[model samples]
Target: MKAAAFDYAVPKSIAEATALLGSNGAATAAIAGGQSLLPMLNLRVALPDLVVDLGRLEELKEIAATRTNIRVGALTTHAAIEDGKLPEAFGGLMQKVASKISYRAVRNHGTIGGSVALADPAADWPGCLLALGAQ
Candidate 1:
């Protein structure tokens, strides 16, 4: 199915993105990775007047490691987690969970943020995130 016509924007920063979303309000949808949102858009389940693409925000793709915590960016893909890119503090729990999410295609492009945001009952990340006490 063809997706509904919509305006698209790639915001360079979180502030700009938030401003765009706020301006569009109910008519805008933020897109990152597009693994989940693409399917929904194609299925006509999500019809937004404006689709804000956050994929270009490099800051959001960063996975910073700290002494006490590992801060994962919104665009951190399942493949990155599975490849052991995150810190060892988690004891490989996220890697194990990431490896188990759907298939390789999904793993390569699907992100932790998207999975958690979608919160599908069958999605694995939500359970893992909750178990890990992630916010």
Candidate 2:
């Protein structure tokens, strides 16, 4: 099934993205890598009036790590982790989990934030993050 008609926006910055998301009231959906969302949209499972694409938000793609903590941006893809793009301090747990999420095409487009935010019990990222006590 095709998605219901919806408007789409690509904001230049995080603030702009938030503003666009707020403009559509409760009918707004934020799309990053679109791995999970695209399927839902195509299946009409998510009928948002507007889709605010977060792909251009570079801040959401950052990764920073310190002695005490690691901050992974929401837009970080599974493929990145699988390819050892993240800090080595993580001990390869993330890489192992990322490599096991579906296939390479999905991993290339599926994001950690999308997986965790979707809150699917069977999703790997959320369980792994939870086990690691991620904030």
Candidate 3:
């Protein structure tokens, strides 16, 4: 089944996005990669009246590596991690885990944050991230 009709918003900043979400509350859904959310939407498991897309939020798509930490933004795709675009501080573990996420097609569209948020029992990222002591 296809998703029901819904309003959409592309917030330019995290503050705007959060405000939108806060106002919409139960009626809204935040869409980053949409890999996990879209399927649920299609199956009617999620029937949000509004979808707040974070696609235009460039800051959320970033992967910043510091001397002591690697900051992965909420919208960073698994494919980026698999492609070695993230900080080398992660060593090879992130790529190894990313390569094992379902398939290349899914990895290309799925965000690490989205994967963790879903908290699928069988998901690889969550376990790997946990083992790596990620916050």
Candidate 4:
């Protein structure tokens, strides 16, 4: 099935996205890579009145690492992790997990934030992140 009709917005900044979401209330949905949300939208499981695309927000795509901590941006793709784009501090754990999520196509567009936000019991990232003491 195809998704129901909905308006789409591509916000330039986090604040703009937040305002869009708040203005629309419960009828709004935010999409990053759309790995999880797209399927639900197509199946009519998520019929949001508006979809705020966060893909182009550069702030959400950053990655920073310190001596003892690492901050991964929400828009980071699984393919990036699988391809060793992250700092070596993780000891290849994230790489191994990213390689195993569905398939290459999905990994190319799927994001760590999307996976975690879905909170699917069978999903890999959330449990892995939780176990690693992710904040």
Q: Which stretches of candidate 4 lie over 4 Å from their true place?
A: none
lDDT for 96 (candidate 1):
89
Please give, for residues 47-101, the per-residue lDDT of candidate 2 as tens digits: 9999999987889999999999989999999999899887967678999999999
Candidate 4 residue 135 Cα shift, in angstroms, is: 0.6
TM-score of each: 0.94, 0.95, 0.92, 0.95
Candidate 3 lDDT over residue span 19-42, tens digit each: 998987788998888998999999
Residue pairs whose backbone atoms clash in candidate 3: none
Give the alpha carbon lDDT tens digit for every residue of 40-80 in model 4. Answer: 99999999999999999988878899989889999999999
Worst 10 residues of 1 by lDDT: 85-94
Candidate 1 Cα lDDT to native: 0.88
User: Which residue pairs show collisions in model 2?
Assistant: none
Stretches of model 2 off by over 4 angstroms after superposition:
none
- Model 1 regions lying over 4 Å from their true place: none
Computed on alpha carbons, the lDDT of every model, listed in order, comes to 0.88, 0.90, 0.88, 0.91
- Prediction 4 TM-score vs. true: 0.95
Model 2 TM-score relative to the real fold: 0.95
* Total backbone clashes of candidate 1, pairs 3 or more residues apart or in separate chains: 0
Q: Cα RMSD (Å) per model?
A: 1.1, 1.0, 1.3, 1.0
Roughly what TM-score does model 3 have, to 2 decimal places?
0.92
lDDT of 2: 0.90
Question: Taking the tens digit of each residue's C-alpha lDDT, what string does model 1 give over 14-120?
Answer: 99998998987888988887888999999999999999998888898899977778899989999999998888677788888989888898889988888888889
